[model samples]
Target: MIDRVRRFNRTVTQRIGALNDAFLSSDRSLGQARLLWEIGPQGCDVRLLRSRLDLNSGYLSRLLRSLKDDGLVVVEQSGTDGRVRTAHLTDHGLTERAMLDRRSDDAAASILAPLSVRQRTQLITAMIEVERLLVASTVLVTACNPRHPDARSCLRAYFSELSHRFDGGFDPTRSISADEEELTPPAGLLLVASLHSEPVGCGAVKFHDDARAEIKRMWVAPTVRGLGLGRRLLADLEVHAAANRIRTLRLETNRALDEAIGLYRAVGYHEVLAFNDEPYADYWFEKTLDRSTAPAPNLPDREH
Candidate 1:
């Protein structure tokens, strides 16, 4: 597997002109070319560019300087906040970016030109898988205050999705809630998953003083589904629960979310008798995490 992956890496990098200092038959290296593309016509905040590209501060500064020296880009400090800097493309940079786009399209066409229709379909499918897995690998999950802007963004999306999917048109106020107070600090936590600085998923947990933890507000963006992010979020919540000395973990879900139910069952959650009166819940599940001595759930799974 390692050899296959390494050979694939070699083939793709060589085919993509990654080894060339003059990529796309241009004067700039691929790094410089990518910088221009990322800067785009609207420009970008320098710090954000660094995060999105995963570049070291010195390396990014050096690239910006090199582009500036070539008169291909401009970097300027914000008027209100001198500490903040933004990168904008010059006329030449825009032209260069356009040329790069054309060349990239040509390169893609060239790769497909040799393949039969079936091979092309297979190649495209494989490429999609590779891209999805790569993006999934880059996602970062962190515990944060539920009130943070990005956290709120994920919750808003979650609620909007629920409203559309629920038969009666869901209302947050009608359901059992994980309010801001419940998800803050010593009581509970909200975990937000980010991909290239954009929030992609979020999950929360409320503790009952080392006795149990209830998972809440769990969601992953539609664009990023089927990448196992939901499982990652669940495993992280389990870690948090264990750390908090929570012996059991529980969650309730609406019948509209079948995928979520499948995930819970796959990850060891078992249906139990109604433990809470959450209005929207059609199923309630729980898992006991006992380290030293505990039998797995072999008992028949009960459902409401």
Candidate 2:
């Protein structure tokens, strides 16, 4: 499997001119070119560019310097402190980007030109699947305050989704409490899952004591649902619970959400009697973590 992956990488990169000093027939190397693209029309914060590309600060600084020297990009500090830096494309940079776009389209066309119609379709489909999985794996989950803007945004989306799905319609006030204070530290924690710096999902855990931790507000956006984010969030919450000496994890969900029910069961949760009188809950489930190791192996769900 390792050999296959290496072979695939070599072939794809070589064929795509990824190793070329001038990518897409542009003067800039692939890294610089990509940085320019990411800057976009509105520009981007220098700190964000470093993070999104996972580049070291020193290296990113050198790249930005090179672009500035070429007169294609400008880097300036904004705000009263003059500490926050941003990189913007100059007019020359916009013209260069347009050229790169054309070259990229032509390069892509060249790859398909040699292939038969059937082969072209198959290759494109396979590439799409690969891109989707890659994006999914790139998702980052971080613990944050439930009151943060991104966190609240995710919850709003989650509640809106629930209202659309639930037969009687969902109401946050009537639901079991997973309030801001409850999700704060010493009581519990809230996690936000982000893809490309945008929050895509969130999960919360409220610890009652050393023995029990209840998972709450677990949700993923519609666009990112099938990427196994739900399972990832559940596993992360379980890990957090275990770290806090929590032995048993429990959650309550509505019957209308078949996917949620299946996700709970797939991860070794056993259905139980009503643990709490959560108004929207039609089912309750529990799982005891090993504590000695990570969460249990994910059993294949029917949908997947």
Candidate 3:
């Protein structure tokens, strides 16, 4: 598998001119060109650029410095927040960026020009699948404090979504609680899934007497729903449960959430009698965990 991946990487890099000292036959390396393009005419936050490009601070700063030296980019403290820095393209930078775009388009055309129509279609279809899987591979799931900003973000979005989807709206106050105290260590744990440093999903499990746990706050952002993030989060939660010696895992959900209900059933949970009076719940599910032999759900490695 590793050999195949290395072969694919080699082919892609060569085909895309990633191995070239001057990408797109330009004077800048691939990293410099990408940073320049990302910092569009309107500019971008330096921090955001780093996050989006997944570059270390020093490396990103070095790229910005190179661009600055060439009189193509400017880095300045944001007027609204002096602590924040923004990267903007100069007139020359914009000209260079436009040239880069033209070159990039031509390069793509050159690659496709050699292929037959059917081959082109197949290649593109394969590219789409590869890109989707690559994005999925970048998702990171790890234990998180419920009160942390990312966890809070997911919870707020989760409630807002529920309010819109549930009949007559929804109220957290009326629903069963999965408060910070309950979700913290010794009681429960929350898992937050992030992609490119932005929280995209979250799930929590409340441990009860080391034998049972209740799943709560299962949610995937609408934009990332089709990426199987919810499943990944649930699998991680299950692993945590098994490690903690939990014998059974259970959850309740509103009928309006058809997808969530389907996920629960597909993952071995079976419908059961109402376990609790969750005001919004219309279905309950439970899954017995076999500590001795149940295999963990297959999941992609968490992004670092």
TM-score, each model?
0.75, 0.73, 0.88
Stretches off by above 4 angstroms in model 1 are 1-7, 18-24, 28-32, 41-95, 113-118, 290-304
List runs of model 3 lying over 4 Å from the truth: 18-24, 29-31, 50-71, 74-77, 295-304
Winner by lDDT: 3
Model 3's alpha-carbon lDDT is 0.88
Comparing 2 and 3 by lDDT, which wins?
3
| Candidate 2 structure quality by residue, lDDT tens digits, 100-169 | 7777777778889999999999999999998888889898888878778888999899899999999989
On TM-score, the candidate that comes out on top is: 3
Off by over 4 Å in 2: 1-6, 18-99, 295-304
Q: What is the lDDT, from 0 to 100, of the residue 64 in candidate 1?
A: 94
Q: Residue-wise lDDT of candidate 1 within 1-304, one digit each (tens)? A: 9998899988988876643323546767767887888888888989988987889999999999999999989999966688989999989888888888777777778889899999999999999999999889888888878878888999999999999999988899989879988988689988888886688999999998658989999999998999999998888878777777789999999999999999999989999988999989999999998655432322221111
Which prediction has more favorable TM-score, 2 or 3? 3
Question: What are the lDDT scores of the predictions, listed in order?
Answer: 0.85, 0.86, 0.88
- For TM-score, candidate 1 versus 2, the one ahead is 1
Instruction: Show the colliding residue pairs in model 3.
Output: none
